[model samples]
Target: MHLILLLSGLSFQFSHGLQPQFVFFQTPKTWSEAQNICREQCFDLATTHDMREMETLLEVVKDKYDDAVWIGLSKGKTRRWRWSLADDDFYKEGERSYLLWRSITDDNCAVFSNGKLNMYSCETNKYSVCFDATKQGADQYILNTQRMVWTAARDFCRAHYTDLTSLRNDAEYQIVQQVANGSEVYVGLFRDPWEWSDQTDSSFRYWNPDMLVRTDSTQTCVAMLKVNSGKWGDRACTETHPFVCNCIVKKLSFIKLRISPQDSMLDLSNPSVQADILEQMSQKLRSYNKTAGFHLKWRKQSDGRVFTKEP
Candidate 1:
């Protein structure tokens, strides 16, 4: 007895998937006006989560847009200091909230030098200390001899070790000082006033050195400079410029497929068989469009079985 799989004329809509799209507007408008227009057409002003998203946004900018363009970042009303080691599990009760700054300044990044905590410009190049949680005893803190800015040092630490050293208490501070070895080192502590227009919690920042030094409070809105390697810079919100907008759309699609069983004893009602079928279909879909991401699953019937036998 040969078992034949039948094709259904009906295509089922399983789930909705979200994908991001970046749109550029050449018309000049203030940041607020641009944001309003973006909301009207798309989702909101563009907000990037990481370098990959930033690169995607850059791809939207071609010969038509060579100057700076407004993004979703803007200066917040208040500033807060936080550690680069953002893992909450590493800290107990009030440890993450602890601060031991000897003096605060216009600078945003922190450094330990000459036996005192001082705020320094984030652009200043200095040696950094990395913390290794897996190491035992005195091997926790490792010092990097190469000089780098605060952000670069944090990146290096995250790539190699756990993260830049976070001083949770006095004992941790002593260990960090020993790692510094009388030389100034960039610590995990830093403060920022910038906030995303979409109200996301992404802490990733890519600011030019010039923008980091500016103390202008009126320069609230941020722009991505195509001429300066897409580095972000703060500008007045009232200044008119071409802006980028982002839309995250949920798309529903119906896919149809046909299956033929070579073996007469094959069971199509089995869960494993349904999973294998979905996997094969997913691979075929990927071959057609490499960039389009989607999830695949078998649609169940009223009895919770994926496939039903036909008379």
Candidate 2:
């Protein structure tokens, strides 16, 4: 049997998993003002992860507000293509911006095929080429034959090697092509303009179908329309409306966890033991939604004890 300790507080218990506490503010405020207020309260504008979250938010504001509401999505100013391998020391001066794109489109992720880089949607699956910095000579670039999405490929590379291959210059690009052997392979280059206010990496988008190409420069910030079944639309940042703030739970309610240990003498209170348990739980939670980020920690009691013997 495995011990599963659950912590509850002001957090919204979603059917998917643990989620941030969302507070709906009826008072209308511009996007900037709402962001400022949320920041002041140690929170930020709400960020939805999927359609389940969209449904939850829709239920929250459907009856109270019959108009649009601010969310954290916005077109950030520093929107540019970047590499998954973020180590600056790995690239020479002026080599960081080197790219070999066959054609540029709205698609962000790139793939190397037939000695040319092609922009592709991140959801597309392809074999991944990973870079192993510790390896010497031609053995550095390792090709993973498994077909996986861009993000999953990145995770696999990070777990086994340095990262997805970063083609710094023509020399590196040629090396990657040789490793690919004419097969299309995922690379590290990608560009995403949409950003959340809290800076969380959330790729899930629920955009209104009609506003896919609605690129009005003035309407950079995003809002969810209650009348449109919570579909998101870009709006001017100066426009005022009710907003949702993602808040952190201030208090914690703990539940006892019971586990049958393989070793009878094992100490459950050991920091390493506690950490291993948390890691196990985190891995299980990640299996539900690999893209969603989760922060799990052990909450100590007033006496600095995480676990107590139940007599």
Candidate 3:
């Protein structure tokens, strides 16, 4: 009898829905390169179908890597978003959700942009993420010095590392600033009024503080880490100085969840039970969505008090 009961329990466990496990690559690679790498290794680029999986992946890689890598999700030729590796037709089902990984609309493909750890289109030129056999590692900060046109430098960085050294955040910016103050290496700090690249449809610009200086119509380029006080100055991009490149480190973890048998008891059969289960599941999903996987407790609607219900 005990053996039969054990077998039945095992069967029940298998019958419940199970969450898929996902892996991530932290090394930057171009979209195609990333896909090729993943294919060669018998692994597909990472994709997140729900918020729980996304959070689990983020926590896993939070320490192992820093720079973001490419994932399997993309907006394909049909302009209909689809998972690059999965055959399922793209169906959002009108559910509003938050994206834990980076996503780009125009390019239809996604890349992890350096600094911001956000998504971008594959067609868009930016740094890429790559992976190896044992464990995929993050980008390492590298410094390169070169002489080229402003356009050429941008191109070079796109081909090689992350963009011409955009600051990742306030902490990173301060670090770069301190380094420039000491060695006077030219950073990405530029002086030209930021303009949109013709390739992109939007006209958005983000310039570092005091990085732009308007001296004359001839000042077409910008320079960083001036010799005296490490202030920004205008110079031709062609001017040569040692440049900085960043290698990002990212940590990734794959988590899989299997619904408990007791939890599954919330009848998926009867219409009323199905509706109630769906309503509860929706509420739980909404709670998960709000924090992007951060822990949150349920609260009362009237008094804003946290409460737990007993089954």
Candidate 4:
């Protein structure tokens, strides 16, 4: 009996040592940004898939002092309790322990205490941990559309595409608007009238203050004009003139300086060589800006070559 007990202790120690050490850190980031950081900088969101893993985490962090940390669980977009880390179907016919309170009310946020689960406000501060995983590149688009509408155009885009093409910045919006020649297209803009189908209680609705539902039934879709126009108006979805499609293009930039045989170092005085360098630099700048037609001029400097936009 004594020998068996000792062997069991040794096995436990071996297993614990093999487990990966979880690193903890505190960050002031939105829930989405925090999740993105985990994927881009650290790893995938920490997944407490089983009681054993949960228990292991609890034991490891039981004594460590820290505020609650965000986890992968959340009140999903539809207000359903879900594991935001993956899209796999959650099984419901499990033992009570398996159904342990990993998810809470539809508060849109979650946290972890040591390994225990807690639901919290998204704005609350907390430490977070992530597991190891590879980062995937953003998807790129080829041909895209840009359009404007009354309200109908906006609805049409929503019904057709995945979602109104979301623009992250002004530059992107400007590019799309320019391509579409100021035509309005539907975006993700919606008012309080829009109802989420998955919400358990249908009594309440989410609304964006900037956008309000129009009284006119014809104003179903939303449209935009210039990049600065932040307001949205509802219109019919059937009328199609021009539309905007958010396109992502992969770009690469390389800067090379060449040295002539006569010079011990790079030749900065050679006008021809300087021109070539400027052309390459211009091309790179255009790539970053996602511009198609642009001209560049090269100027010779004492140390290197300089590239500038051509007038």
Candidate 5:
């Protein structure tokens, strides 16, 4: 038998798995205000990772509010394009998410289409551009110089050196372009959508075709308009509208967790044991959503005990 402890908005229950509970706020508020309210009232603004989540989220907000309700999705001006293999801690101020697209398009979204910068459907298989960090200093780009499918080239690069290269600024782009010799080679730049307010990475795209090409630069945040079949669009963060918040059940489920017999001597209440458990749990949670940016820890009781046996 497995012990599954589920905590959902101050309620304790047994569940097969953690299920997100959506809370809709009918009152109008700006994106930031809505986020604050969501944190105050629920867990945070809902985070969607795929079409399934987007569809389910739409159903929750359908017909509840005429205006667009803010979820967690937004085009944050501060944080934009990130490197695929680079650690987030290595990013310096104003050194990441940098983009200067070759083409000027109305839509904020962009992707490589027909070997040129277009919009959306971010994933593509093409030649690889690998960055070699082992060379030291900033200049670590390793140009493959050979055209191959993205997967194969990535494997080849990893086998011999590091994985695909990532371009964060115009300088990197220029370097890659020069190395490509006027041919379109694949860098790590991708048009990922639906980043959560909590900084979780999710590729959920629920955009209305009409929602493309945001006119106002100030409107960096997004909301799901009830009339547009719950499709999303960029709106001013100051815009007031009803919003949707999602409460994630922080569930620590032990469904037949195999413990190594060699480690059976330690007591469960040991601080070191608890720390190790928390660390392992954090790693597991990361695999579920690497961008969630959450830290797992043991909760304390009134008497300062980290845990207690069930009666």
Candidate 6:
């Protein structure tokens, strides 16, 4: 299903079953500079999550520029599979395994059974293994007997235990799998295409076999060479080039809340009170910030009045 997300004043549509639209700027800059510009103007440097996105990126920049453009891909240090749970301090180096499916379907979720990891649709219903830190020994993997989708499983785990079980090693995986009782269970072992920047765990990669040779010691950042069939290759981070950027947005929900203050003597038309309310709302918004953050805005009335007083 598609959803709309609000980032400050910007909005973008994204859905599991839809191909996202891409916009390009012809401005030339280094990879870092291009990323800054994109985040400021669009979203971030274009993230080609799949072949469809790559094809769209190519078509979007076909006539916009004659040179290569910088996408979000880069060869950064410590390539790994980040867990759905964002607690970095929980899992240490060498504790997590890097496994991914070499398939074209954008199934960003993972399930493990029979000692194998497979990518599955996020919406698929299945049992889940939740990591209970409070439990001792291998009793941590709490298998939910009730079947639910991955998102629902995650929510259940978070509400009841820690989260979807994040295995530290093969021993841990085997234990969690046993908790599944021969049934495939969802684990936090999914691969995302976010390789370098943001480590989005997105496995989506578009590389030209001819241009993928790592020869130069200094070339680390990646740029899509338009002359080379939009193939990505490593380049010095200092190199200047016209880059392509993709606007990444989350599906945010807009909620309207009408506040009715009970004060009789206070002036409802006062601008200071409105400013103070907005300021307080901004602070509250900070608490709701997550991987997909939320923002606060005034829901103006037909007459352009943001606040209305009812007697």
> Which 10 consecutive residues of model 2 have the lowest summed lDDT?
7-16
For each candidate, the alpha-carbon lDDT, in order, equals 0.72, 0.73, 0.31, 0.31, 0.58, 0.61
lDDT of 5 by residue, 71-189 (tens): 88777544344344544444444555565556654333343323344433223345566877687644577767666554445446656766567556566666676666665666554
**Candidate 3 lDDT score at position 28:** 49
Q: Which stretches of candidate 6 lie over 4 Å from their true place?
A: 1-19, 81-198, 211-217, 248-311
Error of 5 at 30 (Å): 2.4
Compared with the true structure, what per-residue lDDT tens digits does model 1 show for residues 1-311? 55545433223322112446899899989999998887666667887765557778888875566678999889887776767665445777677767787878978889987556789888889999898878975698999888998878887886788678888888888887887999999888888777766554345566774455333467889998766787888778998989988766634355444555788677877778766876787677656543233445455556765544456
The window of 10 residues in a row where model 4 has the poorest summed lDDT is 5-14
Candidate 2 per-residue C-alpha lDDT over 1-311 given as tens digits, one digit per residue, 9 for 90 to 100: 43433322112112223466788999999999998887666357887764456677777777777778999889976555767775545767666678877877777788888777888877787998999989986799999999988877877887798788888878788888889998999988777577777655454556664443233346789999776677788888999999998775533334455656677577777889977977787677666654344345666777777765543
Best by TM-score: 1
How many pairs of residues collide in model 6? 11
When summed lDDT is taken over every stretch of 10 residues in candidate 3, the lowest stretch is 7-16
lDDT of 3 by residue, 1-311 (tens): 11110101110011012233445554545545554564344233443433344455545454443323333332212222222111112213322121223333332233222322233322222332211112222233333345443333343543565344433345544444433333322223222222211111111111122332232334333222324122224433333332211111122232222233355334333456534543565456545432121111122235532222223
Q: What is the Cα-based TM-score of model 6?
A: 0.42
Error of 6 at 273 (Å): 29
Over all chains combined, what TM-score does candidate 4 have? 0.21
Better of 1 and 6 by TM-score: 1
lDDT of 1: 0.72
Candidate 3: where are CA atoms >4 Å away?
1-18, 81-311
Taking all chains together, the TM-score of candidate 1 against the true structure is 0.56
Residue 50, candidate 6: how far off, in angstroms?
1.1
